[model samples]
Target: MVRGKTEMKRIENTTSRQVTFSKRRGGLLKKAFELSVLCDAEVALIIFSSKGKLYEFSNSSINKTIERYQRSVNEMGIGQKTTSQDNLQHLKEEANYMSEKIELLEASKRRLLGDSLESYTIDELQEVENQLEQSLSKIRATKTQLFKERIRQLKEEEKILAIENAKLREKWDEMQSTQKEIVEVETELFIGLPQPRTTR
Candidate 1:
């Protein structure tokens, strides 16, 4: 009698799972070999067991098959030709990626240079406009604050200079009075009048 179909679940018994893994891995390698021999096709198989053991098989030298694959890729002119459907799809994907990158670069350039956003799409232009406005506002605020600070400094300097001027004027007045007293005393000495008893 035929057995029921196996359920799609993990094998519970460790020994049974190991046995199954060994059998299936051998069968898979055997089929790969047979296909390579019967159809003259290159085959390479690599398997890693649950226990992390590595296994590998190749119809010919694995390196040779890899070199052949590389040669085929080069012969196809992988970058130059996009004629096939798969190649065309790949090219389209690349084009989309490049377009996005270009947009990002342009946006960054515009931001750095402080350019207006009139030429781009509405959404992109709006974004740029917002950023520019923000930058301008910040610059204006900083400029205003700097001007106020400069004015305050100038006022303080003026006040200081005014105080210094007042002090210098008072010193000039004192110097003039001392000079006048000295001239009067010299005049008395020259005229040979009875010298007034000078105060000690």
Candidate 2:
């Protein structure tokens, strides 16, 4: 049978808790060392115990690493240093470019939505009107073509219906003539027959 899972509450026994902390701390440090070795990375770790004791570990001398960190920070201008002026200039230029792009996109959107055309200069308005007129003319031409095609189809359908109606009328006339001939034959046969014996 499988064992039951444990709850997430802290361990209440001091000895057990201490042992767990020691084991986990060793494991964590070992993993950190392995990561640094495998990835060629510099690693530093600091720890404080409940007794107010301090401990530190570094892949290299602590002083050298700290000096390097300080130099990098100086170059980055983190403490009133003006070393990053070039980077600031580049960022300002990039911001200006982005602002211009945004303005262009907004203007395009406004044009697409037909907003504020009256604010444009007369020359700009004339250009826009010319484009619109061209588009409208194209649309009208397409619509006229479609309407002509539809009318042509309707005319053809009407012609077909008229032909079918003529054929039906011809058939009806033939049927009526046949019926009239049968009636005439029956009348002749009755007249030619000896007159039926007088009723007495």
Candidate 3:
């Protein structure tokens, strides 16, 4: 006959509970041994009876297994903490490097802007002097070119004015000669006596 499913409640009778505990504990230990042997797996089991009697089983040395378990757990925690500490150290070092780089850049910027040159070496000062000298030379060359262009323009204007002044002088000389001829003709026609009758 098929057995009915057993309900998983406490057995009410004390004798029955003790009997069940004894039978179940023996069956559990037997299964643990079988599993370890058949699967070649490590197994550990522990039990306490209602009367405080202890029963235990282990495929290997129980103490060694327990120590290994503790170390595994501790290693997980320690590994995470060690990784975090390493990352933090790397970040701190990187930040220090960046800070030093920024300080150097700021000092270089200050030097370019003509500040803090008292500690500069002779070669560095000479470099700055050479740059300024080149700039001044370019500026002077540009100024000289501008002055020459202005002088050329002024000379061209003087030539044009001289040509215009010569034309004006020619016009004035022509006007003066024409006025002198007219005056002489008018004097001869009006102020002279009738001397033409004796000239026959």
Candidate 4:
């Protein structure tokens, strides 16, 4: 049978917990040594027992390896700070671009609405007039489309109403024929004899 995965929590029993730590520590040290030899790499391992006993392993001097690690970490911090400054600069530039674009659009809108025309040249005024004419054309086209759609909807409604009226007229004719038959029977009963059939 396959072994189940061990839970990643503290071993509750004191003796079992201690034994597990000792076994894992030894295995870790052995693995570190093998990795250093196989890869010809600078490897290090450090461990402290629960009772404050120290254990360590290193392919080079442990103090020297630790110093090198510290210097590398400091250099990484500097690089990250520089990257952060670059990101800040990029965001500032993007904000400036958006601000300029917004100002341009606002200016265009003011010109379209005839709010600020004192600074415009004759050519610019002509351009604005052309833009307004194009805008009006588009608006008229949209209005025409809506009118056509409404007409189509009304025609469809009219057809449906005509069908309903025809049905009502047919039902009325049926009822009138039934009433005529009933009246003829009543008249015959009142006369106490059947009348000769005649077209009504």
Candidate 5:
């Protein structure tokens, strides 16, 4: 059976707690040394006991490792700041593009609705009219296609229904013929296991 999780709290008695802390501190140092040797990592660990006694472990110079950590953290902060600035710039450009596109679409919509045609040249007005006619033609063609598709679907459904109805009718006829045969058998007279001899 799998072992259940044990609840962990602090060791309450002073002697037990101190002993536990000393054992754990030794284990932690051993683990840190193993990690550095096995993984080729620069490891550092520092522990202070309740009596203000210091315990320390390091695979390399602890000062050098601390400096390296600080340098890495600073570089990460700088890289993040640069990335954030780039993202902000990209967002601003996208917003501008969207704004311009919206304005163009709104102006085109106004022209299509015959609301903003006062500024258009004759050629531009003719072009807009042609666009409207083309759009209307495409819409009508699409509508016609949908109606044809619907008609096809209805015909297929009707054919299936007719086939089903024919099958039902055949079953019904078979049932009626069976019932008639039963009635004819029941109506016969002199029903017995042996046949009777004819009289002279």
Candidate 6:
């Protein structure tokens, strides 16, 4: 009698999980080796254990195989890939589109700079003029914003300086009053002194 298929789930027991991992890893490596030998094909396999231990198999250098795979995937797009000839044609079309875009941009730049306008239709010239006007408006708005910010900063600084100046003036006035009081006391003491009696 055929045995039922094992229901795959996470092995809850730690010991069982390690044992399963070891068995499966060996089985997988064996299959990979067998496939490479039987088919005479390049093969690379990499597996990482739960503890991050690396298990790998390669018929040839794994790096070379990885590079070859990457080149194949990129040069011919994945999933029922087109031929190299098709890829070349697609690239040629893309290049042509890019060249056209570059040419258009150069023409627009020339028109914007007031260098070449003879070939442009009226509509094209109008479009270029609109772009220039929008750019100028944005620049003017930015300049105004910067000036306002500067004015705000300067006002803030002026107010701070004004408050500091007021504090210094109050200190100076207090010092002056103290000096005047000291001088007045000294003057009173000098004037209130008694004269010594003269002998004949």
lDDT of 5 by residue, 16-123 (tens): 899889888989999999999999998989899988999999898999888977876887888744477767986999799999999999999998999968889999
- All candidates: TM-score: 0.37, 0.40, 0.38, 0.53, 0.45, 0.49
**What is the alpha-carbon lDDT of model 1 when measured against the actual structure?**
0.86
Greater-TM-score candidate between 3 and 4: 4
TM-score of 1: 0.37
**Residue 25 lDDT in candidate 1:** 97
The digit string of per-residue lDDT tens for model 4 on 39-83 reads 998887899998999999999999978996786688788874446
What is residue 5's positional error in candidate 5, in angstroms?
45
Please report how far candidate 2 places residue 65 from its true position, in Å. 47
lDDT of 2 by residue, 1-200 (tens): 99799677788998887787678678878877887899988777677755667766778877877786777688678555554786798689979999999999998668646788878988887777777788899999999999999999999999999999999999999999999998778443344567667785
Model 3 clash tally, residue pairs:
0
TM-score of 5: 0.45
Which residue pairs show collisions in model 6?
none
**How well is each residue in 62-170 modelled by candidate 6, as lDDT tens digits?**
9989997897788667566667887898699979999999999997778889996888899988888899999999999999999999999999999999999999999
Arranged by lDDT, best first? 4, 6, 5, 3, 1, 2
**Cα lDDT listed for each candidate:** 0.86, 0.81, 0.88, 0.92, 0.90, 0.91
C-alpha positional error of residue 83 in candidate 3 after TM-score superposition, expressed in Å: 31
Over 1-200, each residue of candidate 1 has an lDDT whose tens digit, in order, gives 99999888999999999998999899999999999999998898889999899998998889977886786688687664435986787689979999999999997987658676456687876777787799899999999999999999999999999999999999999999999998778443255567679788
Worst 10 residues of 1 by lDDT: 186-195
Compare the candidates by TM-score and give the number of the best one: 4
Off by over 4 Å in 4: 1-82, 186-200
Number of the candidate with higher lDDT, 4 or 5: 4
The root-mean-square deviation over C-alpha atoms between each candidate and the true structure, in angstroms, is 22.1, 21.4, 35.4, 20.8, 20.3, 15.2
Better of 1 and 5 by TM-score: 5
lDDT of 3 by residue, 61-147 (tens): 888778867865897877744467767986999799999999999986787678999999999989877877887899999999999
The TM-score of predicted model 6 comes to 0.49
